[model samples]
Target: MSSKLRIWVTGASEGIGLGLLQHYQNLGWQTVGSSRRTQGPTVADYWIPADLSDSADQISAVNQLMTEVGWPDLVVLNAGVGHWATADESARSDAERVFALNYWAPVEITRLLAQRAEGRGLHVIVISSIAARFGQQKLATYSASKAAVALWAESVNEEWQGSAHRIQLILPGVVSTNIMRHSIGRDGQALGDRAGAHRGWSVERTVRAIERATRSGRFAHILASPGVRLALIMHDLCPSIFYLLLRRKP
Candidate 1:
């Protein structure tokens, strides 16, 4: 058996997943990165080129990983997709695609692995977002999807307590990534650029926060800065007033 700690990360082609994979690799851990992209620049000691959005792909990828790497010490179900559309506009399209990848797929994959594993210690880290706390204007489905994952992680954590199985949810605020590129604005154009989506926390900074939380064995980690957390707190405490004070658009 490999003496080094091994971790499997999904959605490792770009953004937070790529960042985390590289960080662990630098720390000398055996890292596996899974994504639809296979030919381009890749990190980690191993790569599983598969699209997690498809059930067959998810199954094939996990089975291949199991065959090649056996049981990983940690599994990061970071594969997700985001869209920016209002409820009215979203009705025009099939929302199930987003829901399937962002919510159901991760839950299914984790459940399958947990059920199959024969008493091997496992820690699952899932990427959620601060948007999950409540409904956001341009993030109706995105928010709901993340919220579903976070809630599931929490329930699973409780269910597996005092056992080797564990789940950790990392909820991030706005981070600089391509996710914002696909967002539709209130003006029917791209919304991310105007909202300063490209100016949020850096990939490295966000990864640092996640690592810190993992070391502390916390159940949840919100990757927003202190100021953002305060705003969320104010909104939670007085949502009506906050709603009146805040604007739906940038």
Candidate 2:
């Protein structure tokens, strides 16, 4: 058996975060899970509740985890929401709410963990989206927020060049999750039918990739699907072409 590692997974009540929590716990690692609500699985060692949109609550939750678990060997910032709104119909409040949880909250949590885990072999995993690679008509805000997160992870990885601590960005394509089912457009219209087919691997496959990447500790960024990987490369090589292809109506 592999040596158990102390791990913390945010947004652990459901989706990728919950899957990771279960996987690690089954691996004999001590896992701490956090979510805004109390619907998380019962396997985690600690379930800290806090609203990620509130800075104070986020900080308090982290502090509470630190007090009880010291510093986690791995911290996965996997809690996020998806919003699709036309530029004009998207309310300012809606955009801000999305940024709060998807971008700002993760940045704050990672910053605090980086400081607390200094000198330790800490690995921070950020679950960004393939949307960051190219622009989608109605998902402008969501794409931008994820792009910010991916960029932030790259910057932090650069900063930790000579240190033991590392940051990994997991950019996943559309997966089977409640986020897709519950997505709404700027006009408060349901985008469920427009979500398109699931393109790549299952959530389990992505979780396995994360586990392998975490163990290998070689790649700083992980593209969850072949399509997303290709899109990312294309975006880097020929952004115009990538955008043109991604701009098709869903």
Candidate 3:
């Protein structure tokens, strides 16, 4: 039998990253997990410990990852934080931190990984959000950051088409994650939300779509369920109506 494919996932500590890690691990992939901590959160074949919030740590982590694996067949850029700050309550630093993890970290690490590939085949999967498509309610910074990464993936797919890399931009609707609660919930808590999180999709559901898309050699996957996809479509087709519908209740 052929050797199992190798993968490296960032933000392997929890949520979507954790889901992907566990799935791939169970499938017998030669997987490596990276997070701020060296221990706990998961048991992978290998681990890459690096806090992506710091540039030095990021560079070190990438260097260490390349040293250990040379280049993984696939790199899942899934590490990010959830910020809960109102427009008046939020600070510039908070937004910057979100952007650092969500946008810049992924870009730099992916850049290093792509270059390391040296024209070999590579799959780059990014876990973005359906929130990327809409500027709804109070998640301005979070929404913007997700949108930024999605846009970056578009440009990357354009620039690297004939090269070693193919990018997967996944825009998943609200999943039952703490990060989702933090991003969509009020007072930074879901509060048993009627704001649609109870009906939010599962991490497994989202990751399965990712797997399917990857197998098909596709570049984009929007894993929004029927209603969610409709709402997003409506948001695009009728921005004014969506603006009113998506806003929180008074």
Candidate 4:
């Protein structure tokens, strides 16, 4: 048996997931990565191509990981889809797809891994969004899905009290990723060039925060700008004032 630390990261082809994959690889840990695309950036020791949103593909990917690399010491459920339509403009199918990948995928993966852990220790990191904190405009489905996963992790953390298994939730704000361009639009198409521009923490910084949180055994980590943190505080401490501020935003 190998004593090397093993890690599995979904959505590892690009963005934050890719950053995490490289981070673990540089640490000399055994790295396993999965993504919807068959061809990867050749960063991981093992790459399993699967669309995590689909139930069968999710199960198959997990089974393959367990069979090939065995249960990983750490699993990062970072695979998710984003939506960018107003609540009224959102399509039912697109909403379901968002939840399928962003919410249920991580939840199901957690369940499967726990069942396989069989009392062995396991740490799962769920990559939620800072948007999960409140109902923001034009991101109803995306926010809802993230909020669902965030709450689910919280509940599961309580259930695993005093147990060997642990779940960590990571709520990261906008990173320099193609997520906006890739977000689903009102017509169930990629927002593409129409998506609004955003700039925030780099993937390296976000990954560093995640690593710091993991080392400190924090239950939840929020990687966002100071302004975003202040907004969240205001939302929690003064709801009426928070909404008033939001309304005033142009």
The best candidate in terms of lDDT: 4
Candidate 3 stretches with Cα past 4 Å from truth are 40-42, 180-199, 248-250
Q: Where's the lowest-lDDT run of ten residues in candidate 4?
A: 37-46
Give the Cα error of residue 103 in candidate 2, in Å. Answer: 1.1
For residue 213, what is the lDDT in candidate 2? Answer: 75
Estimate TM-scores for all models. 0.91, 0.88, 0.88, 0.97
Local accuracy by lDDT, each model: 0.82, 0.80, 0.78, 0.90
Clash total of candidate 3: 0
For each of the candidates, give the backbone clash count. 0, 1, 0, 0
Q: Which order, best to worst by lDDT?
A: 4, 1, 2, 3
lDDT of 2 by residue, 139-216 (tens): 888898999988988888898898887788887776676776556666665577776554456668778878887777
Q: Which window of 10 residues has the lowest lDDT sum in candidate 3?
A: 182-191
How far does residue 223 in candidate 3 sit from its true spot (Å)? 1.3
Candidate 2 residue pairs in clash (backbone atoms < 3 Å)? 85-186
Listing every candidate in turn, what is its Cα RMSD in Å to the true structure after a full C-alpha superposition? 2.8, 3.0, 3.5, 1.1
Model 1's alpha-carbon lDDT is 0.82
Worst 10 residues of 2 by lDDT: 217-226
